[model samples]
Target: MSKEGRNANGIETLAAETLQRVMEHPATQNDIATVETQLGRYPRGMVAVGARCVGDGTPLVVITGPVLPGGIPFPTTMYLTSPEAVKAVSHLEADGLMRQYNEMLADDTNLRAQYERAHAAYLAFRHGLAERLNESEEHIEGISAGGMPVRVKCLHALVAQSLVMGPGVNPIGDMALERMRNEFDPTVCRCVRAQSDGQETR
Candidate 1:
């Protein structure tokens, strides 16, 4: 199911968008520290990835792209060069794309083996993200390393902010989304969490 959002572009749009967001994620040496301080990120307990939650930003990369030929290694990948931004994939492709991704996953013996080996990791991440969003707080960020432009990053933010974890993924709200658009910079946007319980998600 498609969630409502300011943008409706598909994953093809997000592939390039991912590259663009990386370009805008310019983090100075202190940006991560600053964001961590602002978010009060502290680890609740012993987690394998982060030493502590408070000081660390969970890096999530959404591999939003086409299901490349199975022969290619890493058909989809993400970059986290931007210090300010964590990671993101397009509102994730729709069910169709996911099916194709899985189909390709089954075909590529090496990749399929990798997917099996990492299947637990994938489920854990999804579980963690769902838990995080359901329980306390969660924010979305997209960044690029090549410096394509800021608008691409903002577009990703738009998609991320619009997402909601409901019976099915959807958009949060229109006004909440409009609130993020910027006339200047055009690409950079501040993602605001929709505290409303019945809120829609993209």
Candidate 2:
């Protein structure tokens, strides 16, 4: 089907357009180096910087290809790379927030519908990325990260999606992010590297 037809069919054309822009620009060597430090390993199949920190403008989320270089299937598209963000989200998970989110999803009909939409958008975005890369999407078809459309499994994945797609894309992610504002604020540069660099410059 044509791109327009696919958009009309409820595929997130806006996300596809954003993916195109990201592909056109690509990530810099500095971005890769920083992400390596943040993740403690080289990120595989990284496409571009999906989102940046509001304060220091460092890479916050990465957009990865649907398949790795070795032809391994990777369904996760938006990956959170910042250590502070990861730690904050991990704290939330440790606090049993996922159980609360699952309960909310069970009771709130509107929230469930919103989460379902988020899942569909995630799938569309992953398929769009795969198509752009000319990679096969068969292995990860219908699979979205964050246990979407049914339950809240991972706040890290959900928050990554929210950061990349912006607010309102993932309701549970938005909620998680809101709750973690006291712990981690994206608008503030709480990155360990950023703090270390500040100390050295002083």
Winning candidate number (lDDT): 2
Residue 100 accuracy (lDDT) in model 2 = 96
How many backbone clashes are present in model 2?
Answer: 0
lDDT of each: 0.28, 0.84
Candidate 1 lDDT, 103-186, residue by residue in tens: 554566654443332322222233333343342212222222111111111223222322211111112111222433342111
Cα lDDT of candidate 2 equals 0.84
Q: 8-99 in candidate 2: lDDT tens per residue?
A: 46547657766776677688888887887788789999989988888887898998988899999998889998878999999999999999
Q: What's the true lDDT of residue 115 in model 2?
A: 92
Q: How well does candidate 1 score on lDDT at residue 40?
A: 45
Clashing pairs in 2: none
